[model samples]
Target: MLTVRFARLLLLAALAVLPTLSHALACKEGGRNGNVLITEDIGTTVAVPVTENTGVPIWHSSQRTVNVHCYKDNNVREAEEVYFYPNPRPKQGQPQGVQFGVVYKGQAYYQTERIPTGFSIPQCPSNVSLDKCPAVSFTLSFQVEIATKKPYPGNGQVGINQFEVLQFDGKYGINNAPNSNLVYKVTGLDKIRFIQCAVKVWLNPPNNTLD
Candidate 1:
C-alpha cells in the first residue's frame, strides 16, 4: 500500500508540473515570443488563425498562404497548400486557392475540391456592413487515412499521428520566400477515432518592427 501511494503521489506531481514545463518549452522554442502550437482532432472542420500577442503584422499584405502536410505516425503522406488572395480577380472563384488533398495510408480519403470560402473583417465602417468589409480568412479540412490492405472495423478512423506547417514569407516573391520560411513542428495528435483539424498562420514582423 505504501508503494502504491508513493507512486500515485509521484504521478500527481508529474501531471501538475507537466503543463508548466510545456509552456516554458513552447516559449523557448518560439524564441522571445515562443512557438504557437495548434492541433486539429476528429470532428473539428475549421481552421483557427493564430494571432501574436506582440501586435505585429505576421502575414504578408498581398500574398498569404499556409502549406500543411499530414503525417502517419511521423511519415508524411498527404499535403495541402492554401493561398489566400485578399483581392482575387472577380469571377475567378473564391479568394482561397487550395491545391492538395488529405491522404491516409497511401490512399486519398478526402480532397478540398469544393470547400467554402473562409473570410473575416477586422474593422468595419459605421455605415458599411461587417460582412462587406472582408479583411482576411482561411479554410480547414480533415480526414482519416486508414490502412487499405487491412481495414479496421467500426469507424475505422486512424487519427493523425503528426503534421507540419510551412509558413512562407508573403512579402517576398514566391521564389525568394523559400529562403525565409518559418516552419512550425506540431505533434501530440488527437487519438479520437475522428480528428478535428484547423490551421491558422501569420507572418512574424521583420526584426520585430512594423516595417
Candidate 2:
C-alpha cells in the first residue's frame, strides 16, 4: 500500500510540471468574411485595385503584406512558391496577361503563374513593410494587367477568394516535404488541410472585373 501511494504522488508531481502548449496559429476552418474562427491564426483578405482606362487596357495594381506567428513549433519557413487550389478563375471579365509576382531584392518583382503568401506579423500598409518587420515575415506584391478596356460593371471582390493556404519547405513558414527537423504540425488543426488553411481572400470590384 505504501508503494502504491508513493507512485501516485510521484505521477501527480510529474503531471503538475507538464507544459501546456497552446496552439499558436491553428485556426478552425470555414472562416467567414471578417470572422476569424481562431484568434492566433488570423486569416486576412487583400484588396487590389483594377483601374479601367478610357482607351487603354484595364489596369490592376496592388501591393500588400501578411503577418504570421509560430509559438508552439520551431524552424518554420516561408515557401519559395505556393500554388492556388481550384486554380484562380475569373468570373466576370477575361483577364489577359494576368500574372502574380513576388517582390524580390526590394527592386524587382518576380512574377509567378501561381499564388504566394507574405506574412508581416502585423498588417503592413505596403507590400514590403516600410516600418520594422517581425523576425519571421516578408511582404508581397500582386499585379494584374492587360485586360479588355471594359470597366467592371460595378464593384465586387474579384480575386482568389477563400482558398486553402498550403505550406512548403522553408525556415519561415509551412512545409509540405513534411520532414522532422523543420516540420511544424498544429495542435488541433491541420496546417495544409481545409480544416486549418482557410487563410486567403481577394475581393473584386462589383464591376465586371476578373480576379
Candidate 3:
C-alpha cells in the first residue's frame, strides 16, 4: 500500500510537469508570438485650426501614414495603396481651389512630402460641449495592392489635400462658420494617381483645456 501511494503521487507530479514541459517546448519553437515591427514615417504635423472657433484651437487634421513594412522576422508583404477623400465643400465660398493648392480658411496649404501605406488609430474620445471637452474622429479612404512594389521599385504617390471641420455648438469656442463649427470641401481626388499604398487617418478634436 505504501509503494502504491508513492507511485500515485509520482504519477500526479509527472502529469503536472507534462503541461509545463509542453508549454516550454512550444514557446521555444515558436518564439515570442513574433513581434509587430512598426516603421513609421510621419510627415510634418501642420496645425490646421478649426476655423469655427477663435479662442478654442484644434489641431492635427494633416494627412499622416505609417508604413507597416513587415510582421515578424522582417517578413515582407505586397504593396498596397490608399486614396483618402477630402471633406466636401461648405455651403459658402468658391469651394477653394486644389489647382492653386489647398487653402484652409484664407491660408494656403500643401500636401505632405511623404506618406506611409498602413496605419491605425489607437484611441478616440468625444464630448457634447467644447467648453467641457472636445471629441476626436478619424476617417481614411484609400486603395491597397496584393503585389509588392520593390527591387525595380514602383511609385506610391498619394495626394492628401482637403478639409473637414466638425460643427461645434455655441457652448464650444466662438462658433465661426454657419454650422457653429467649420466646414471644408474636398475638391480633388479623382485627378491624382498612386501605385500601391493604403491611406489611414483620424480627425480628432483637441481637449478644450489645452487652449
Candidate 4:
C-alpha cells in the first residue's frame, strides 16, 4: 500500500487570512490598473489503492494552474513578475516528498527563482476601457511528481515523502520586477504564490495524506 500525502497548511492559511485591500479597485471592462486580482482555485487529488486497477505501484502527478489577470484601475503602474516567497524552507540534505515547478509558454520555472509571467498588458487606449485593450492573460501551471514505484535508494520508502505541496514553492521569494512600486498579493495571505483553477492539492488529512 502506498501512502499518499498532500499538504494544505498553505492553502488553509491562504484562505483563512485573505485580507481586504484598502487600495483595492474594481476589475472589469474599462477598469484600469485597479489592482492585480488573483484567484487560487483548488484541485482534487485522487488516490487508487494498491489493487488490480493499479497493477504496478501507483504514481500520481499533481498539478496546479494559476491564471493571473492584470486588471487596470485608476492608479495603475505597469510592472513585471509576480513575487512569491516560500514561508518555511524546503527539505534539503534529506529525502524530498514531492517535486514541483511552473510552466509558462513551454518554459519550466522552478520555485527557487522569480516567477516570470511573460505577459504585459498594453496601456488601454485613451478612448477605450481597459477591457477594450489587450489583457495580461496567461497561465502558469505547477507540476508535482509525488512518488515512484521504486523506493528511494538509501531511505527505502515508497518514495522519500520529503516534499510538501507548495504553499510556497520554497524558501525562495517570487515577485514582480523590483522597485516597480507595484507588487502581487495572495488575496489575503499576500505572501503566498498559489491559487486559481485546479489547486491540485490535498483534502482532509493534515498533510492531505490519502490512503
Of the candidates shown, which would achieve the greatest lDDT relative to the real structure?
A: 4
* Model 1 quality (TM-score): 0.19
Off by over 4 Å in 2: 1-61, 71-96, 111-211
lDDT for predicted candidate 3 compared with the true structure: 0.26
Total clashes, candidate 2?
31
> Comparing candidate 2 with candidate 4, which one achieves the higher lDDT?
4
- Tens-digit lDDT track for model 2 on 171-194? 232222212111111111112111
Each prediction's Cα lDDT score? 0.28, 0.28, 0.26, 0.33
| Model 1 segments more than 4 A misplaced | 1-160, 170-179, 194-211
Off by over 4 Å in 3: 1-178, 194-211
Assess candidate 3 and give its TM-score to the true structure.
Answer: 0.16
- The TM-scores, one per candidate, come to 0.19, 0.22, 0.16, 0.30
Higher-ranked by lDDT: 1 or 3: 1
Which model, 1 or 4, shows the larger TM-score?
A: 4
Model 3 Cα shift for residue 164 (angstroms): 3.1
Backbone clash numbers for all candidates listed: 13, 31, 23, 30
Candidate 1 lDDT by residue in tens digits, 1-211: 9999999999999988654332210011122232323333323332222221222221111122232221111111122222221211123222111112332223342232322223221333456542343222322333322112222223423344344422211211121112222233223333323213445455575346443
lDDT of 3 by residue, 1-211 (tens): 9999999999999988654232210000112232222112223432221222222221222432222111111111222221121222334332111222232333332332213212321211242222222222223322211111112112322234333322111111122322222222332322333334344454455443432
Q: Which candidate is the best by TM-score?
A: 4
